[model samples]
Target: MYRILIADDEPMIRKGLQKLVEQSGQSMTSIRTAENGFHALQQIQEERPDFVFTDIRMPKMDGLELCRQLAELDSDIQIVVISGYGDFEYAQKCLSYGVKEYLLKPVSKKAVHDVLDKLVRVSARQRTDTFVPVSRLEQWIAEMDDLVWSLREPELELLLEKLRKELHHYSLKLARFCDVLEELNLLLAKRLSTRDVFSLQTHLDLGGARDVEEAWSRFAEGIWSIVRDLKARRKGRAKDPVEEAKHYIEEHLAEEVSLEEVAEYIGLNASYFSQLFKQSTQETFVQYRTRRRMEKAKKLLQQPHYRITDISGEVGYADHPHFTKTFKKYTGFLPSEYRQNLGIE
Candidate 1:
């Protein structure tokens, strides 16, 4: 039920009608009163109600004058002229001033209830026609932002379809479309403002859109671009622990670095890094380090000036004996034999 304002000179009439309207429909329906037509107009100007019921014979300004002024003020406000059977002609005159219903002086509960039902139907039609609240519009824009952030394409499609249908419910004006576009743009912009790269305003402008479909096209494209850029940025910047560990190992091959040290250097837990290293390189850390040491020893052995004993210490070995033993195992010959074989070659 709609909000109602009851206008009458008689105190009992205003109170009785207010009580009837309150009981006739819903407790939610707000009912206000005025002593005369002049006071009723003043209250309406302050705050417009959905419906007005005024007595035909009132002091200061009569109900006929109120109806006339209300027609000029807002034709949409549903008006019901109230008067006795003796003033039926006076009440009928209110019809030309946009008054539709009439309430007889001896008011009945049934009469008020019937009038409320009629007013409710008219109110329902007006609500659906072109009366979406600003708060509700903001809520819709907020939901759109949520979908965009999560990159929910399927759900976004459905939301866009819902918004498209709303286009018919409202006036098809470019200004209103621009308002929605701007609100959505600002919301996303604020959400991503802390990020280093990408700006929604630079990516798309819905101001040039001729209609709702075009505006949606531009908006969706901009959002998809942001999603793509976000995905690309994440993929490109992702750290590779194994590759970093391998590079560190290759650089410090001669140095005796433990598996735990390498894991610490790469910011990984020791036990987890051990498994990852084996999976990535197919060799334990010690095995890989020993293999690299042996390979480095062979390179030093080829250069005769760098003695085998010096190469032993250079390759992280404590003694020449250990290095020779490990070298023979790796190359199928002792370090001296490998040197001799290279000389013969």
Candidate 2:
């Protein structure tokens, strides 16, 4: 649920916004009002609502000055200015404050709802860090499969673990994660054994990964060629059993998560899955999950709307210190430091 603060001198305007926020849905719980910008700042300091709606013209401090002061306090605070005057200079000043969006006074309920919807969408995308399209995960999975097929026993174990951690941390699906692994295993054990070097080259010619897109196509074509060669020598590919396991990890990141539990989710024997996963990704599943959780913690920390405790839980860290330790290991800065730097940048 989101906490909202409405700061307007007019009693009627404040009541109207309060009712509108309630009517928006159950996602909003705490709704507070301040008669002026000064009170608004004090309420914000004490409560720290996720969003603030204030009238540009207020007693003591105007919305522009209030936003300026609020940014000094917490730059990440979302401010929407509401004023009947609609001065261009005031609106221009808001951009400097990093206000996400602004609203003119004579506030319409529809306008408020529109802004809220936009905020939710931005928040959701930011949470996922879906910077790379969801489609890209499949490609990375394919690349992991190819890399795994060419490696020997000990080396394979190390690589697989690394891949597993990266996948889990990034929240890639288990089925997709496992499918590429399985495909590589099948190709390496069977195809690579009997095929000659020239024969393997012929295979690469099919979807020659010559171009940038094809080079990083995220498919097992390049790896399948090696498997084709090994299989001819009567070397058979090992079947990847961890396909279902990766999906389980991603779906349950917020819960009590561990490699053993992840293995159990896909009905795999724990020790075997751990070994195979390590062989394929060159990382332990635990390391990858922690890395990812910390990344999320970093992003969430950058948003002032979320407290450290909430961020800890949100990113799958059981304790703040633990989260802090892992976060610093991955990014050199504590979560709070990372956030503070982000504001300055």
Candidate 3:
């Protein structure tokens, strides 16, 4: 017994659709009607209907805008857009917002019944198929963040494919999909800062995309562009082994990075690279790594949500006691005392 809303500009059409839906003998609990998209949005907010039948052209807001707003508010609600033949392409674009069906002008009783029947079947399937747990979603987002920061072309393409599959499989609305993109953007900004990668803020405008596919395409392109720019920057700069080692250290702060590994990566002897690192940074490799770990640990401590153990692991200390000792040595206070002193708890 799903609640339904029919929004159209004309009174006769609204009445006709309402009557048609009632007479269709569908499993509907309530039937509501509105004269335009704005009024329909109001009804939706108040009633939280399960399905919406809206016209393409309406006052204050069009069907597409209504669909977009509705998706942001509630992704679970199903939308069926009604449009004339002239607005067919526009109606097609509304599908990106997770519209279930598109009905052309002068919709017949049979068409309404067929759409309702299809909705019932689709809803039934979705009940089982599209129920992604919060933990799984978080895992996917974390994996995506890792792949983006890896800056490998093959992995990037795999991520794009995964995104496309998730978009279809989860039936993600524009809002949720945009949220995924936003998380990726944040990860890019955080990880690429070591190499001075360009800002992706302008390119992450998912709201301005014409459709979901366009948004995804733009996002993929932006990732590729970033990868290319990073490569170009690396190539254009004269090889500075010490600077390269520093960038590598910054990027791999969580890893158990060693001077030998970095020296090998930069095609330099370990002893020579060690001297160069100490000379350039005014600190030995071990001291620099410790300082970076302590600095990151302090920043993580400032956030109350981060547990001391979690912060310890994040900064590459597997043993909690060791991390506490190191933190105290660097900041003159244990992580807990530091947080308490700052009144973070």
lDDT winner between candidates 2 and 3: 3
lDDT for 88 in candidate 2 is: 49
On TM-score, the candidate that comes out on top is 1
Give the clash count for each candidate: 0, 48, 0
- TM-score, one value per model: 0.43, 0.37, 0.38
- Between candidates 1 and 2, the one scoring higher on lDDT is 1
Each candidate's lDDT (Cα)? 0.75, 0.63, 0.76
Error of 3 at 105 (Å): 1.3
Query: Which residue runs does candidate 2 get wrong by more than 4 Å?
Result: 130-345
Better of 1 and 3 by TM-score: 1
Cα-lDDT of candidate 3: 0.76
Q: How does model 1 fare in lDDT?
A: 0.75
